[model samples]
Target: MDEITGVFIQESREQLAEMEAGLLRLEQNPDDQDNINAIFRAAHTIKGGSGVIECHFIEAFTHLVENLLDSLRNGDIAATPLLATLLLECCDQMSSLIDVLAAGTPAPDAGLLARGDALTERLKQFIAAQTKQPEASSAALTVHDSSVEASGGGVVITDSWHISVRFGRNVLRGGMDPLSFIRYLASLGEILGIETVTDAMPAAAEMDPESCYMGFEIRLQTRSSKADIERVFNFVRDECDLRILPPHSNLADYIKHIQELPEDTMRLGEILVRCGALTQAEIDDGLHLQKDLTPEAGLEGEGTDQTPPTPPPPQLGEILVEHKVVHKEIIDAAIVKQAQVSDNKSKEARLVRVQADKLDQLIDLVGELVIAGASANLLAQKSRNGDLVEATSVLSRLVEDIRDSALQLRMVQIGDTFTRFNRLVRDVSKELGKDIELSISGAETELDKTVVEKIGDPLMHLVRNSLDHGIEPAALRLQRGKPATGHVSLNAFHDSGSIVIQISDDGGGLNKDKIHAKAVERGLIQPTQTLTDAEIANLIFEPGFSTVDQVSNLSGRGVGMDVVRRNIQALRGAVDVDSVEGEGATFTIRLPLTLAIIDGFLVGVDKASYVIPLDTVVECIELKNLPTDRNFLNLRGEALPFVRLRELFEVEGEPPPRENIVVVQFAGKRAGIVVDQLMGEFQTVIKPLGAMFRHLRGIGGSTILGSGEVALILDVAALVHAVSQGEEHRLLAPPARHKLSAVQNVRQ
Candidate 1:
């Protein structure tokens, strides 16, 4: 697809999201006029954009939806639950059309076209019903403080919109006929009155035939909005100055409109008359009074030395106020709106749209820069020159700053991601005949865009599982002394350089007995095995594990949980569950903030080096300082399991006389990694391992050091799990030297 169509599709999808969100809000508050207007605007914007790109399949269908929304906005129809549902379905269909466009499909398939026809027929019913009802004063109009009634007697009392426009001198030379725009405007509403102003026209002999000089004052009666009227001039906006005032507009609206008008040579009184702020007689009277008050008017025949009574001439604004044609407060508000408009324009100028792929490419270049900076610092330090070392150190710091800023460019708030679940929760609850409400908290937590995109599917699965199997039915909830309505919540927060998302529900918790029996029946575990509550809860992540006896459409087939775990692990993240038997259950997922460059603590085991993510490193200590028994260490009165890299990787070398123990923590669990040397900190750029290492545990990825050697980045979560699981096994079975010593002997 071309760039224009691609951008259109992206923007259309965003509008669909807004429409869905606004419709949901309207369902909650039926009398919310602001909500209704916002929904209507979203639909109108989508339809307008689609029309601009000639996507008629979308534009034609969206026109029907817009009609229904316009009826709601006009208060011709009430906001009903069925109406809200239909509007949401329209949003879905519009999204499907956008997807088809993105896929380069020339048009929708027969099935989709038929679906659109059905939606269109249903929408017409609402519009047709609205047509049968007698028109009433719109409640939506009264909601705005600018309404005429709210201003008492100090407002323009016309039921028609007033428009003032002036075509640029070069309009005719550019081959655009000003009459064409006027004719098109007539199509939207009745032209109550129109006056052509030829004041700028020169004498016939001096006039340039091709240079146009014309303007118009028009009164239009219509139900169309100001935006709809403004769009009529979109093609010639750059070649014309236009102003519009709605029906029954207040004095403040007229004053604001006057301030926004371009500087013209026309007199102030004439400008006011053209803008419909004052009648021709009212302006003529004001101008005549001002002319009489001027000292020049008293100097008849150039011989009157009367001193003109020392009276000041009245300005146009002062004259209008003095004659009670306008208000002072309106002028003050006009000043404020002008200032706000200026500030908003300045802010808009600072925003620019960038393609995502370009941003990703920039990040990749920054990662390479970081590695090159590290290599330079290494060479400088080895030379033992103070000036070179300091220079390289400063360059390294600068490179680090750039790396951080580049990564930050990819960070986005998770709120948009969290908001999408509202529709899902709403639909799923209705489908299951349950009254479930989803509450979101801590949604402002920001993470890498890559991580956020990849995390959505896993999140969907967990949420659906909670809705389907986790939350009990309304009847069962009430019988269990719970409220008839169920609650599911999605919460996110930052923890120790990781983003932790939790999906929780207030319903019947997991039945441990059922899971245990199911696991045993599937031979996932030995019948004689005994496990703690946490371990039993986590067994759900096992492949093909489910307690459901009969398969259902939602999730009884037991296919998602294992894939969820595998996907999370692919990002070097972890997922686990916790349950309270009857209280409820919560699934917690912990993932790194970014998968690109990481601050890692470099360590050596035998002749090989490994990097531990610096965020997870608590501290480092000599192994001889603590008592080490088997595979665990006693540190400050606490037992911390230690994983020996030399034995873990089966390195063939004698043990060092003294080793360092680097204490690392993940998900609130601390472990010690035994290594030969503590190489301090290093900037690590994570490179994924090849397919051959797909099943490799303990090693997450590989990185290149300053000395051009490959250092393995440890999979901290997996290693921590291995330590915990090994400890549990040692406690449950006959243990001899904790298995590491055997590996050490074999390597030796």
Candidate 2:
């Protein structure tokens, strides 16, 4: 598609978003005029722009939508739940049409067009029914000032409206015929009289046959307001000279239109009088009122002793636009020249829409910069030149700043993702005949855009899991002493340097006995094994593990939560479940702020190096009085579970004489990892591990070192959980003294 078409599609989507949001708002507050105006404006813009680009299919369908809205604004039809639902359906259909156009189709398929036709008929039913009512059956047309004073035989204009229109020369070429507009007007009202202008037509030899040169002056009889009448010519407003004069309009009103028009005031007034708006009788009545309001002293004497109290004298016929009522013409004009106002402090302030591919390229470049900067700094330090090392150090700091700024560009608020579940929960609750409300907080928490995108599906599953299994039916909940209406909530905030998203529900929590039985039945665990409550609660994430007896459309087929766990872990994140038997449950997911680059703490064990996220590193201390074979260390009278990286990765050679314990925290647990050397802070660009390394337990991803070797990035969260679980298991079940001594003797 060409640039123009692409822009149209993009703008069309924006308008659709406005429509959908306004529709939802209307559902909440059905009497909100601002929302009604917003919805109307979105639809009007779509219709007008579609005509400008010659999208006849969209224009035709949107015209019907506009008619329905016209009646709504006129107070002929109340804003009902039925109307909101129908409008929502119309929004969906508009989106489908936009998709067809975005896909380079000139028009929608026949079936799609049929769908539009059906929706149009549904809309027309509302409008047609409205017009057929007793009070709205008659059309009110005011002969516009342009021709009420113009000459026509036996044309006695009643207390009706007058409308004058002169089409632009290109109206015909723009796919709008003057006569068709006339037919639409007739549909709105009965035409009292019509005078067609052909004076712009050239002689036969000089006239361009394809160009239009027609003008129209009609005296219409209708019950519509001035705003409604003006909207009749909304499509061709910018391409025409149009004016509507309400019934009983005086000479001043006619002169206002005349001064604004490209014509003499007197001539315009004569035309209005001819069309019956500025008739002699109205003119006589206005002059009589003008005479009555004058000061009596001015008529009686030049300087009387006292002046009678009367209204101010008449000034010249100068009308400021502010003095006039806000008409549909002004609104149409505003829409035609709409400008966007930017809030200085908004995240979208001064934003330019860039393709996602471009952003991805930028991130890739920033990652490369990070790698090269580290390499340069390493070489500079090795050269042992003071000035060179200092300059490279400065460059490294600036490079780090640039990397941070670049990564910040890809960070987006997680709240937007969380809020999408509102409509989902609404639909699902209604489908299941339950009353549920979803509340959200901490929507401003930001994370890497890529992670945000990939996190959505998993979060969807988690929320649905809460709704399906966590929240009970209304009757059951009431019987269980819970509220009749269930509650689900989403919350997010920054924890240390990571983002924590929680989806929680206030309903019946998991039944540990059922889960345990199911686990035993599925052979996932042995009944004889002892487990903590957390460990038992987490059994739900096991593959193909569910306690539901029957399958339903929502869930119970046992295929979701495990995938949620896997996906979260794939992002180098972790998921934990907490629950009480009858109170509630909360699933927590923790993730890094950005996946592109990070400040990592480097460590060396024997001949290998590893990277641990620097943010999780709490403090570093020397290993003192540590047990040789035990996994726990006594620190400050507290047992700190420590993992020996050398033993875990099976590194070669003996342990170093001096060892370091790097204290780290993850998921509310504290642990230590023992390494041979502390290499301090380093800049690392994250590179994903290959499929072979995906199952490698402690290594999350791999990165290149400044010394030209690959260093594995430690999966701190997973390792912490593993070590904590190990310690818990050991304390729960330890080997017998005789068996342990025998095994030690055999080892020696």
Candidate 3:
């Protein structure tokens, strides 16, 4: 599409979306005038824009819709439920019509057109019925003619002026009707006289019924200001000749009236008579006297020194008004422009639509810039030139700033994601005949847009699961002394550089005994196994694990929760569940702020470097005299499980005399990794491993360092899980580690 067509489509789509939102609001608050006015404006804009593009069908349809809305706006039609329903259907029809236009097809469905026509006819009938009563007082003489003839000169009327209107042939076919204009004028003043001019009509056999060959000479008297009368004909002024004059008044009023007309209009004496500024006799006398004067004498009398009569200065307000640049009412509404000028001062208050692909490209460039900055810094250090070093340092800071700003562009509040669940709860609750309320908190939490998009499905699954299984029925809740309404809450916030999203429901918590029994029946766990409440609660994430006795549409397919866990892990995130017997269950997923870059600690284990995310690392300490018999460390007198990376990765190396250990904590669990060296902090740009190595455990991905060596970034959350699970198994094995140690020592 060309630029203009593209813009039209974009604007139409936006207006349609606004119309939908307004209709929904009106459904909820039918008495709200603001929402009604907003809906009207949307329709009016669509009508005007469609007219500009010459989309006659769309323009005609929207014009009828606008009329219906006008009735609502003026309170001629009360907002009955039937009217609201029909209006919503009209909005739907308009949307379908726009889609058809976008696709370069014909108009919308035939059914929609039929319904729209019926609705329009009904609305017209209602409006006509409401206006039939003679409500205006007879004494209100607002309409009067100003065409009365005078002897010396035409009597000029000011406030009480009237006009005799004459319609040319084919006016009705041109969408011009004298009655509508007359009625509009009546809204401003009373009609004194209306004489139809049929003198120009042709024979009946040559005439078309729809063609308006009649003219009107109207005499209207009014207290309305002059501008009000002009506005009544504004829309049709281009198609018809219009003139406004003052009532019978002194010469001063005539001069004032002359000054009111534009420079071109002042020369038309006939127009002045027709507009009630002068009588026809006055113009005839001027013309007759001019004919008597000799042409040569008249020309000589009008000397060059006569200087073309200077016209009166134009009204600044009127000049602004004529160009359509500003409205006179707006000036009257606000005497000062400061408020209008300052309206958009708050930059944060505006929103713009950005293509998702553009954001992705920006992030990719920032990642490359970071790697280049690192390489430059390394070269500058080796050059030993002060200028080169300073430039590189400044470049490095700029790269950091660029990376930060780029990432921030991809950060979006989770509130929108959370708000969408409201409709879900409402519909699902109604379907299941249950009373459920969704409460959300901490929705202001921000996360990477890519992660947020992927996480929505997982979050949705969790919420549906909670509502289906975790929340009890209203009767059951009441029986348990709880309120009939069940509460499901979604909360999100930042916890230590990672965004934590939690889905919780207040109902009977998971049935641990039933779950354990089911796990054993499914061979997911041993009957005699012992587990903590937290550990048992997490078993729900296992694939094909469901304790529901019978399957239904709401849930119990047993495929969702496991996928939720896997998707979170793919983002280098972790999920956990917490529950109390009868209170509720909470499922929390913690994910990194950005997937592209992170602050990492470089550690070497047997010549190979690995990166541990710096945010997860609580502290680093020397592993001097660490416990040999136990896999735990006394970290400042606290017992923390520690894993030896060298052994874990099966690296061939001799033990270093002073090994370093990095203590990392995630999801309330802490572990220490033993490494040969701690290399402080480094900016790590994440690169995903190839498909061939995607199934590899422990390593999340690899990144390039300043020295052109690839460093593997440890999946700390996965490694922690591995170590914790290993430790648990060893503890349950009844001192079998001695046999394992002998086997391990032989390998070492």
Candidate 4:
């Protein structure tokens, strides 16, 4: 696809999103005229954009949608749930058409064409149902200003648009027939009157047939907007001058239109004449009166007396106001609008559109720079040169700054992703015969764009589960003393250098007994295995574990929850559920703000180095004598479980003397990692592990060190959970009870 087509697809999708959102709002508040107008504008924009790219399939389909929206805006048809749903479905069809365009399909398939035809029929039904208003006769013609003045001060009483156009002299030489444009204009509305001017024509002997000279003053009666009328002359815009004044426009409307004209500036008389607020004859008469008022015209006794100062030519604006031709308020509004437009243009000039891929490429290059800077700093420290060490230190800081700046470029707010679920919830609630509302908060929280992209599907699945399995039916909810309307909420915030997204609902919570029973039936856990309520609640993440007795379309094939867990884990994040027996369940997902790089606490396990995310590290201290039979440590007063890195990775070596415990915390749980040496802080650039080691639970990813050696970054959340689970399992074992007793004695 060409660049223009690519831009159109991206912009068209955004426009469709707005359209969908607006339609949903309109459904909720049928009298929201502003929202209805916004929806119309979005549809019109898509149609215009598609037309520019010659995407006739999209343009044709959207035109039908636009016509229906126009009717809604005109109050011919009221906004109803039925109309909103149909429009939303049309929005979906537009999206599908965009997808086809992106896929390089020449045209929509038979299925899509059929769907379009059905939707078009529905749209026509709504529009054609309105009472048809009769078109006014084209025989009687009136200029614009007279109609307004006839109704007293600056008030327009007729619904007729006045259009004025002057074709360029080179129009014919450029192979464009001026008459063809006028014929096209007539199709948009009835031309009540048209007067052609040949004043610019040279004498017959000097005239050249190819050089054309013609202008038309036309009064049109139509329901189209000024923009719609302006589009007819789009092809000839640069080669002609065009002005359109809408129906029922006051003096201010004409003034504003003159201010927005393509030319930088025009004389007041010409501005008025062009906008159909006045004719050339009226302007000529006004100018003649102004000329007579000039001081030069009032000079007495020709050349003999004292020279009187010649006052500047009476300003045309003043002259018009003096003659009661137009209002001063109109002139003031025009000035204000001109200033506002100029300011807006200046602000718009500062923005530039860059492709997403270019940003990704920049991030990758910055990641490499971070590594190179780390290597340089390492060599500088080794050389034992003070100046070089300081220079490398500054370089490292600058590289760090650059890395941050580059990463920030890809940081986008999560609100857009969250907002998309509103439609999903609305449709699913209807399908399920429930009244559900989705509320979002903390939507301004920003995260890496890459993380946001991959997180959408996982979030979608979780929300669907909440709607399908988590939120109870309205009848059931009310029976349980809950409101009839189920509420689902999406919230996000930054915690400890990571983003925490919580998806919660206010309906039936998870049933631990049902889950536990299902786990046993599925053989996910042994029947005799004792578990806490939290553990039982999380059993929903197990594969093929479903509490539903009957299969339904939305869920109960035992598919979604497990995938939600797996996808979140794949992002080096963790998801867990907490539920009370009667209240709804909440799924908490913790993910790194950015996946590319991090600040890490380096440690040595015998000779193997591992990096712990610095944000999760509480502190480090010597692993003093404790009961050798257990991996728990008494930190202050709490029993912090510890994971020995050498034993976990199976590093083949004898134990190092006087080992240190690096305390790390995740999800409100404390744990310690036993390492031989504390290598201090390092900027860890995350590199993905190979497929062979992807299943390794404790290690998240690997990073290249300053010494040109690879160090595995420890997944703190996974390690914490593993230790906690191990402690739980040990407590259940009879043999470990004696060891735990010994550890308790040592702690005392």
Predicted model with the maximum lDDT: 1
lDDT, candidate 3, equals 0.74
Q: What is the C-alpha lDDT profile of model 3 across 263-324, one tens digit per residue? A: 12223443344333334443444455445432433344354676443334544334433533
Determine which window of 10 residues in candidate 4 has minimal summed lDDT.
739-748
Deviation (Å) of 388 in candidate 2: 0.6
Residue-level lDDT of model 4, residues 39-133, one tens digit each, is 88889989988999999999999999999888888677778898889999999999999999999999999999999999999888877776465
- Give the poorly placed runs of model 4, Cα more than 4 Å off: 131-348, 737-748
Model 1 agreement with the true structure over 57-117: per-residue lDDT tens digits: 9999999998888778766789998999999999989999999989999999999999999
lDDT of each: 0.83, 0.78, 0.74, 0.82
Q: Count the backbone clashes (under 3 Å) in each candidate.
A: 0, 30, 18, 0
RMSD of each: 11.3, 14.2, 14.0, 10.9
| TM-score result, candidate 3 | 0.65
lDDT of 1 at 595: 93
* Candidate 2 residue spans exceeding 4 A from truth: 52-63, 105-121, 136-349, 736-748
Question: Could you give candidate 2's per-residue lDDT for residues 1-748 as a string of tens digits?
Answer: 3776777778888788778778767877888876787788788888887887788888888888888886776567899878988897898888898888778787799999888889988998888898888773232324564545433644344545667788988888889888888888888767988899888888889888778888887888776555567778889877886766565444444333332221122332243344333334333334455566555654654445674455566521112122222233432332222221112224355577777889889988988888888888989999999998999999999998898888888898987687678767876887777888889999998999999999999999998888888889888888899899899999999998999999999878889999998899988888899999999999999999888888878899889989999999999999999998778899999999988799999999998899999999999999866667677778789889878788777688889888999999998899899999999999988999999877777778989887779999999988888777777766666554322231222222
C-alpha RMSD of candidate 1: 11.3
Error of 4 at 336 (Å): 6.5
Decoy 4 TM-score against native: 0.77
